[model samples]
Target: MLLEVRDLHVEFHTRDGVAQAVNGVSYGVEAGETLAVLGESGSGKSVTAQAVMGILDMPPGRITGGEVVFRGRDLLRLKEDERRRIRGAEMAMIFQDALSSLNPVLSVGDQLGEMFTVHRGMSRKDARAKAVELMDRVRIPAARERVRQYPHQFSGGMRQRIMIAMALALEPALIIADEPTTALDVTVQAQVMELLAELQREYRMGLILITHDLGVVADVADRIAVMYAGRIVESAPVHDIYKAPAHPYTRGLLDSIPRLDQKGRELYAIKGLPPNLMHIPPGCAFHPRCPLARDVCRTHEPPLYEVSGTRGSACHFWTECLNG
Candidate 1:
C-alpha cells in the first residue's frame, strides 16, 4: 500500500464541545489506484486528509489514535521535521479551493518553483524552468507567459490547473485531491478530472479523491468508501457501489444523484441532516435518516460486515440493503 490510514480518529475542541470528526476510519490506496472518499460536507473526509497530510490544527484539533502508515513507516510516530520532508517530496495534497490555496501576491511560477527549490535544492533559474515544464505538462497553454502571472490573472479552471501542477511538481508517490472540481462548470469539471486521471496514470501514483458529488467520481474512482458522520458505512469497488449499495447511507447518496430520466419528477434528497459530530446517534449515525433503520439500529452499533473479500458495510441489515 502506498498509504494506509488505519483506525484513524480525530477530534476538534470547539466551544460547543469535542467534535468527533473522524472516528476509527480506515482505508488504503495503492500505487496506480484511485480511492474515492465520498460523503457530504463535515463527513470527516477533509479532516482525515488533513490529518494524513500533517496539516491539521493542533490546538483545536487532535488525533487521539491511529496510524497513518506510508510505505511501511508510521507517519504519526515521525518527528515534525521528518513528516515535513515527506509532505511535498513523497506525498502531496491538492486543496478544494485553488484561489485561496495559492498565494495571491506571488507569481504562479515562483509558487510552483518553490517546491523544487525547497525539496530538490535547485537554483531559482532552474526551478523556474521546471515550473514551466510542469505547467505545460498539465496542458496549460502558453505556460512560458502564464508562469509569471498571479493567481488573480487566471480563470478558475486555469488556477486549478496551476494547483495540480504544483502538486505534481515532485511526482509524489501519492496525492490527495479534496474536491478539486468544486465550483467549476460541468465541462470544466470534466476537463480537470481528466487531467488528474491522466497525470495519475502517467506517474502511476496512488490517488485519494475526496468529494461529495457522486457524479464526479463515477468515471474516475477504482473504489468507493462512503462516509457518514465520522465513520465509513460502506466500501467496495466503484461498479459494485453504483450497481448495488449495501448501506442505507450509500443508497441515499446514490438516489440523490440527478437523473435525466427523472427530469420532470421531483429530485430525491436524503431525509434529515447529518448528525452532530459531538453528539452523534447512539448506534448507527445515519439511523435518523435511514428509511430501513430498525430498533437494533438505535442501540447496538453494527460492526463492519464483510459482504465480499473486497467489500464491507457497517449496517446490521446489510443483506436486506443488498437485496434491494
Candidate 2:
C-alpha cells in the first residue's frame, strides 16, 4: 500500500461542543492508483486533507484516533522533524488555491527549485535547471523564461500548472490533490486533469483526488469514496458507483449530474444542505433528505455493510436502493 488511512477521526473543540469533522474515515490508495474522495462543501473533505497533511489548526482541531500508514510505517507516530522531512519528499499535496499557496514575492523558479535544494542537496544553478524541466513537463510554455516570473504573472491555469510542477518536483510516492482545478475554466480544467493523470501514470505514484466535481472523478479515478455529513456513505470501483449506487446520498449525487441524454428535462439536484458539523442528526445523517429513508434510517445509525464483492454502503436499505 502506498497510503492507508484507518479509522481516522478528527474533532474540533468548539464552543457548541466537539464538532466531529472526520468520523471513522478509512481508505487506502495502492501504487499507481487513483482514489477520488467525493463530497460537497462542509462534508469534511478539506478537513480530512488538512489532517492528512498535518496542517490542521492545532488549537481547535485534533486527531482523536487512528493511524495514517504509508508504506507500512505509521505516520502518526513520527517525530515532528521526521514528518517534516517526509512531507515533500515522500508525500506531497496540491492545494485548491494556488494563488494563496504560492509565495507572492518569490520567483516561481526559486519556489520550485527549493524542493531540490532541500531534499536533493543540489546547488542553486542545478536546481533551477531541474525546476525549468518540471515546469516544461507540466506543459508551461517557454519554461526557462517563465521560471523567472512571479506567480502573479501567470494566468489562473498557468499558475495551477506551476503548483502541479512544485508538487511533482520531488516525485513523491503519494500525492493528495485537493480540488486542484478550482477557479479555472472548463477547458483549462480538462487540460490540468489530463496533465495530472499523465504525470501520475508516468511517475507510478498513488493519487488521492479530492474534488466536488463528479466529472473529474469519472475521467481518472480508479475507486471512489462518497462522503456526506463527515462520514463515508459509499465506496466502490468507479464503474460500479456510476452503474449502481447503493446509498441514497450517492444516488442523489449521480442524479444531480447534468445528463445530455435527458434533453429538454431540467437538471436534477440534491435537495437541502449538508448537515451542520457541530450538531449532526442522529441515525442516518442524510435521512432528512433521503426519499427512500424509512423509520429505521431515522432511529439507528447503520454500519457499513458489504453489498457486493467490490462495493460497500452505509445504508439500512442498500438492497432496496440498488433494486429501485
Candidate 3:
C-alpha cells in the first residue's frame, strides 16, 4: 500500500464544543490506483485528507488518534520537518479551490517553480523552465506565455490545470485531489478527470480523490469508500458499489444521482441531513435517514464487517442491504 490510514480520528475545538470531525476512519491506496473517498460535505472526507497531508490547523484542529501510514513509515510519527520534506516531493495535494489556494500576489510560474527551487535546489532559471514543462505536460496551451500569468488571468478550468501542474511539478509518488472538479462544467470536469487519470498512469502515482459527486468517481475510481458522519459505512470496488451497495448510506447516495433511464420522474434525495459531528447520534450515524435502520441500529454501533474478499460495510443488516 502506498498509503494506509488506520482508524484515524480528528477533532476540532470551538467555543461551542468539540466536533469529532473524523471518527476512526480507515482506508488505503496503492501506487497507480485511485481510491475515491466519497461523501457529502462535513463527512470528514476533506479533514482526513488534511490530516494525511499534515496541513490540519492545530489548536483548532488535531489528530486525536490513529496512524497515517505512508509507505512503510508512520506519517503521524514523523517530525514536522521530515513530514514537510515528504509533503511536496513524495506526496502532494491538489486543493478544491484553485483560485483561493494559489497566492494572488505570485505569478503561476513562481508558484510552480518554488517546488523545484525548495526541494530540488534548482536555480531560478531552471525552475522556471521546469514550471513551463509542467504547464505543457498538463496540456495548458501557450505554456511559455501563460507561465508568468497570475491566477486571476486564467479561466476556471485553466486555473485548475495550473493547480494540477503545480501538484505534478515534483512528480510525487502520491497525489490527493480534494474535489478537483468542484465548480467546473460537466465537459471541463471530464477533461480534468481524464487528465488526472492519464497523469496517474504515466507516473504510476497513487491517487486519493476526495469528492461528493458519485458521477465523477464512477469512471475514474478503482475503489470507493463511502463516509457518513465521519465514519466509513461501505467500501468496495467501484463496480460492486454501483451494482450493489452494501450499506443504506451508499444506496442513498447512488439513488440520489440523476439517472437518464428514469426520465420525467422526481429525482431521489436522501432524507434528513447528515448528523452534526459535535453531536453525532449513538450507534450508526446514518440511522436517522436510513430506510433500513432498525432498533439494533439505534443502540449498537456496527463494526466494518467483511462482505467479500474486497468489500466491507459498517451496517448490522448488511446482508439485507445487499440482497434488497
Candidate 4:
C-alpha cells in the first residue's frame, strides 16, 4: 500500500457545535491503483483527503484519532516541517478549483517552476525550463508561449491541466485529486479524466479520486468506497459496486446516475439532504432516507460487515440489499 488511512476521525469545533467530518474512515491505495471515494457533498470525502495531505486547517479543524501511514511512516506523528518536505515531492494533491487554487498574480510558469525551485533546489532559469517541460508533458498546446499566461487566460479544462501538471511535476508516489472535473463541460470532463488516467498509467502513482459522480470513475477506479455522513457505507471492486451495491446508500447513489435508457423518465434521486454533521442521527446516519431502514437501523449502529473477501458494507441488512 502506498498510503493507508486507518480509523481516521476528524471534526470541526464551530460556533454551533462539533461537526464530525470524518468518522473512522479507513481506506488504502496502492501504487498504480485508483480508489474513488464517492458520496454527496459533506460526506467527508474531501475532509479525509485533506487529513491525509496534512493540509486540514487546525483551530477549527482537528484530527481526533487515527493514523495516516505513508511509506512506512505515520504522517500524523510527523512535525509540521517534516510533513512539509513530504507534501509535494513525496505526495501531491490536485484540488477541485484550479483558478482559485493557483496564484492569479503569478504566471503559470512561475507557479509550476516554484515546485522545482523550492523542492529540487533548481535555479530560476533551470526551474523555468522544467516548467515548460511539464506544460508540454500534460499536452497543453504551445507550452513555451503559454507558460507565461496567468490562470484566467486559459480555458477551464486547460487550467485543470495545469493543476494536473503541477501535481505530476515531482512524480510523487501518490496523488489525491478532489473533484478535478467539477467545473468542466461533459466533453472537457472526459478529456481531463482521460488525461489523468493516461498520466497515472505512465507514472504508476496511487490515486485517491474524490468525487460524487459515479459515472466519472467507472472506467478508472479499481475500487469504490461510498461514504455517508462521515462513514463508509459500502466498499467493493468498481464493477461489483455497479452490478449490485451492498448498502442502501451506495444503491441510492448508483440509481441517481442519469441513464440513457431511462431518458424522458424522471431521474432517480436519493430522498432528503445529507444530515448535518453536527447532529448526525443515532445508529445509521442514512436511515432517515433509507427505504429498508428498520428499528435496528435507528437504534444500533452497524459495524462494517464482511460480505466477501474483497467487500464490506456497513448496513445491517446488507444481504437483503445485495439480493435486491
Q: Which number leads on lDDT?
A: 4
Kindly state the number of residue pairs that clash in model 2.
0
- Alpha carbon lDDT of residue 182, candidate 4? 88
Q: Per-residue lDDT tens digits of candidate 2, residues 225-297? A: 9998888899999999989899999898888778767664676677788888888999999999999888998
Instruction: State the lDDT of candidate 1 residue by residue for 1-324, as single tens digits.
Output: 889999999999999999999999999999999999999888999999999999999979999999999999999999999999999999999988899999999999999999999999999999999999999998999999999999999998999999899999999999999999987888999899999999999999999999998887798999999998889999999999999999988988888777866564666788989888999999888889999999999998888899999999999999999998
List the lowest-lDDT window of 10 residues for candidate 3.
259-268
User: How do the residues 1-324 of candidate 4 rate in per-residue lDDT, one tens digit apiece?
Assistant: 889999999999999999999999999999999999998889999999999999999979999999999999999999999999999999999988999999999999999999999999999999999999999998999999999999999999999999999999999999999999988999999899999999999999999999988788797899999999999989899999999999998888777777867565676788888999999999999999999999999999999999999999999999999999
lDDT score for candidate 4 against the true structure: 0.94
Report the candidate with higher TM-score, 2 versus 4. 4
Which residue pairs clash in candidate 1? none
lDDT of 3 by residue, 194-223 (tens): 999999999999999999988888989999
Better of 2 and 3 by lDDT: 3
* Residue 199, model 4: Cα distance from true site in angstroms: 0.7
* Model 2 C-alpha lDDT versus the unseen true structure: 0.91
Q: Give per-model TM-scores.
A: 0.98, 0.97, 0.98, 0.98
